[model samples]
Target chain A: MSTVLLEEEMTDTPAAPARLLSAGPAAPGQEAAWEQFTKIPLPTRTDERWRFANVKDLDLSPYLQPQPVDETTREELLARSRGLEKAAGRMVFANDQLLSREVLSESLTRLGVVWLPLEQALVEYPDLLQQYFMREEAILGGQKFAALHASQVRTGMLLFVPRGIEIDLPVEAFHWLHGANSSCFPHTLIIAEERAKVTVVDYYESADTNAPGLACAVNDLWLGAGAQVTYVCAQNWSREALAFQINATVVGRDAQARSLFAQLGGRHVRSESVSHLRGPGGRSDMLALTVADNAQEVDARTFQIHEAPNTSSDLLYKNSLDDAARTIFSGLIRVDPGAQMTDAYQKVRNLLLSDDAEANSAPGLEIEADNVRCTHGATSGQIEQEELFYLMSRGISKRAAQKLIVNGFLQEVIERLDQPEIGARLAEMVQAKFAAHR
Target chain B: MSSLKIQDLHVRIGEKEIIRGLTLEIPKGEVHAIMGPNGSGKSTLSKAIGGHPDYTITSGDVLLDGVSILGMEPDERARQGLFLAFQYPMEIPGVSNANFLRAALNSRQSEGEEIEAVDFYEHLYEEMDKLEMRREFTSRAVNEGFSGGEKKRNEILQMAMLKPKYAILDETDSGLDIDALKIVSAGVNAQRGPNIGCLVITHYQRLLDYIVPDVVHVMVDGRIVRNGPKELALELEEKGYDFIKDALAEPVSA
Candidate 1:
């Protein structure tokens, strides 16, 4: 319905071989990780971490491993990969195969910042890839999915910002699932050396609106001492697709890392994020916004670990649920025994727009140090009737009024991003998503 | 040529009737004031005319420009050029005052028709200057964390930008100080012209001093008991509301 065309359906074509992964020889850790992935049992409702989640949807037997996309389909996806107007660099991938790559500027390259596809980076900078690739496991209960991603993720971006250098513009990556009943494993690993600053945006989309697909993604962000990094993940799969996004962040001394996860599409999505403030004076800000409509379900889990003194972590997640949609948020913050002066906070707010919509939130905090400050809270409610009446009294239609209120509710998180261009782009995406429902 | 006519309007909250058989009319190019004591249904009358969901009109009708709006929703009534300046304006978080006013104006336009940014900002800045509102106020949330005076000024700002055919000021002077009262009165006075009519509701005669209504009506119970010219407001101020109460208590000659 939107002017942003994704792809057209092509029927009656014989299915291609699906088990041929494009990734090269896996490292020792990745090999063992894949073995464990095959051995680890699928999650059940009995698991505490997956409580209240629809675990029955985790069956991936019907979805074949990604197959090589046809040239025509690949060209169509490449043409449809529209995003930020200008970026430091951009990469487009479909079905876990690199379709296109735009190299960085000469100035950036001279400064020793390497922005390469994961496969290329594995061959060119093997030492860096081996040291940081999947180094921090998914501790928020997506270990099996993370292992699968490690084994199959051949298409993504590896951005390495060397010491004392800063990139003014953000780098971008687009991952598309092209075929029906296919799966894509997209990984983004970023390492910002001491005093470096960089930002990366990852966009996950489907080529067909009605096709059923699976997307398993992992983003590992490593910030060296005094480094700063901002990472944004915008997931917009097809309506029938299922998605799992696992993210891990490790902040070093005096480093600052901010990450925003925006969930706007998909039939069912489960996101897990973990931030570890491993050094003194390190700061981590975790923000997420979910707009769930229809019968879709979104479940989010997060962990903030304070392992050193003078560390701080703040987390805020907001969801707007409409129709019979459902959302679940479970987050925890823990401070180690010696991590004194640790400041941590977690808050989740769910706005229910329809009578049948539902939200479940569980927030927890564990503090062992004596001088730490930790707080966590969750709230679920409907839009204020008075506010609704106020807008309606001004001659705005009820639907438009609700849209404005929802935008206002989610705008706070976007404003916190402090990057106006990126914020505006996200808002437009929100608008497009809402338009699709209409 | 146009008028807001409320004919024998009886409004209620749940089962208890508030405005009992109130009838009034304010044609274009006139300012009418309704002065009453506490619980005299002055606010209820304005709300009923504005199609507030809380107060339902049990009988009679509210006609805007000769068209009965009894069955219309609040937004529909609003789009028909009926504006209510609330006594306690609601605060909408994260919705900028500029955007709120723009939406109000935009709702009056035809489909796919957008207000030009150049003209909108020019007109908005002109009105803000008249209301003594700061430039930054436009970007702030609608009346959120605003003082009582600021909120009233914002309501006036909306009225100016919306340019409604008929405006209802329901107790707009209740929380305003003397200075704020003067500023708000100036804003209303600036908007006074042959194209607009107004109904100002107040508890005290003090507001009538600044706005200087052309006609003043006194309501004691649920009905307007007396109607007169501007001099009546001065008389009420000198004698207090007790004069009306005493006058009503006297037995009528059959």
Candidate 2:
């Protein structure tokens, strides 16, 4: 591959920001979103929504819009954007620019399943895209970032599965940040109609793991009556990047939604996930795994609201922190008065590998409903000396032993996904990170 | 020189010394049973040999083959062909038995060399069958939710897979019934050959009946007072430990 200057590409067009902004309101309500973003204040130390956060590090001033990639670089990134071995479909994007797309198989397309880039979906199915497009603002302290995402978001995924259609194979999307101090907004919006089921895996990555950049992402999953959806986001931006991922999931009558965030990269990552259990027998499983090391800080906030009777939600978030890394987990379970017979469980576990590493967990519950069952807890601990020595005693080196123990520690959460192939892929990716650390 | 040798080994936990001036050697092709009363540091001896971090060997040296292994880490000592079967085996929650054993075997090889999965599973299943362990034990986490007999058998299963040069069984028959004791002893007996040295630590002669050691050492107050043939275990069982005290009171005799 030849190294070519992106400046030459820019001369043919304008800079990336001007080109993207001049396209004017990429999505509906985006113009108003940019206005709202200017009004929302940056996080402050006194702000309870920003508790235990390094408020100063939330600055977005250092970030600049990335320049368009040269053809050679785009091809290189597209070639490197590997995901699952047998994905039903895939879309790869770099610097908010679509690089490639593997359209769905004929059977899926014939079944009226619509899988397209968000921009293309707006043109082909304008009425369908408007219904679930950034339907609500971020409610858990990411309002400004969500608005910024809406304004700057150029391309992502729009997957719509018709009623009673269950796609056995998962669809994947890869969003890569390719330049230093540049920014990208990636979005994934899924709508599963009544009795329809689908699984989607999204990869948020960086071309250079050491480059400083900004990533603002939003993913919303809407499951209609009896629908089921499983969504996973593997966030592995550069080590010096500041990133935010806002997730909103709504489960209707008897529907189920499970979304997981595998947080492996970034300097400071703040993620907010909220689940709305909207109707009777609806259930939501919110899971997250964070493998944080060095000076990385991961701040995760979650809210599970049971808005209808017989609704349930389960949240499990596990973090393994090493070196001087830090993690914060704050979660709440709310049961409305009309949502009696609700069941909600929230658990957060942090495995601290270094003495300097820190973990903070606060779990809360609000119950205005009768006959509700809700339990929430957070625990932080280091690897058991006995367990480590036990593995080491069998001839595994200290690093290998810790890796094995940590892998086993995380097996519990991975098994809950019940997707063996996807779970194994996630485990392998995590092991690659561990190997890279060594 | 082809033996695991301990020379004047003194072990301590915190400020309190446990094993004082303990000297012993188990040459290849032989099994040495050390029968001691409580607080005699029999368990400490195995732990010190295994290079446990807590049991500090303050003054003496332990040798594997002819090389001093006192300076090595626990894993290095293990890679140097030393295996210790804990009296109370640890239960690792998420590590499958197959993976743990495979790691041990792989650790003994060159870096990045893993054993073939098919051959590993076949060999593991063969050995598990010999120990009467269920086939499902391979997928289950190492020793998690295992019974007393199953835990001991699991330890022996590890010994079978690792095939260490020196083997230490710290009360291998502690909580076993007669049937379990016989099965565990048979498992150990299968590994006894000219290429391996064994040390069996126990309090009762009942375990000795099944294992049938070639030599017996009586330890009291952190010191091995006498070394005798296999018949010594029966004698100790008949006369009880009090007789050893009386015998020690007598004047020195060859």
lDDT leader: 2
Against the reference, the lDDT scores of all candidates come to: 0.87, 0.88
Candidate 1 scores an iRMS of 1.0
Q: lDDT tens string, model 2, B1-254?
A: 99989888899999999988888889999999999888888998998888888988889789899899999999999899999988999888777888889988899889778899999999999999999999999988888999999999999999999989999999999999999999999999999999999999999999988888988988877678778999999999999888896677522211
lDDT of 1 by residue, A311-398 (tens): 9999989999999999999999999998999999898989999999999998988889999899899999899877887788789888
Minimum summed lDDT over a 10-residue window in model 2 chain A is located at A1-10
Using Cα atoms with residue i matched to residue i, what is each candidate's TM-score against the true structure?
A: 0.94, 0.95
Estimate, for each residue in B1-254, the C-alpha lDDT of model 1 and write its tens digit: 39988877788999999888777889899999988889999888877787778897889888899999989988898898989999999988777888888888888889989899889999999999999999999888889999999999999999898888999999999789999999999999999999999999998888888898888888866787888898998898889989889888522110
* Model 1, residue pairs in steric clash: none
Off by over 4 Å in 1: A1-15, A19-30, B249-254
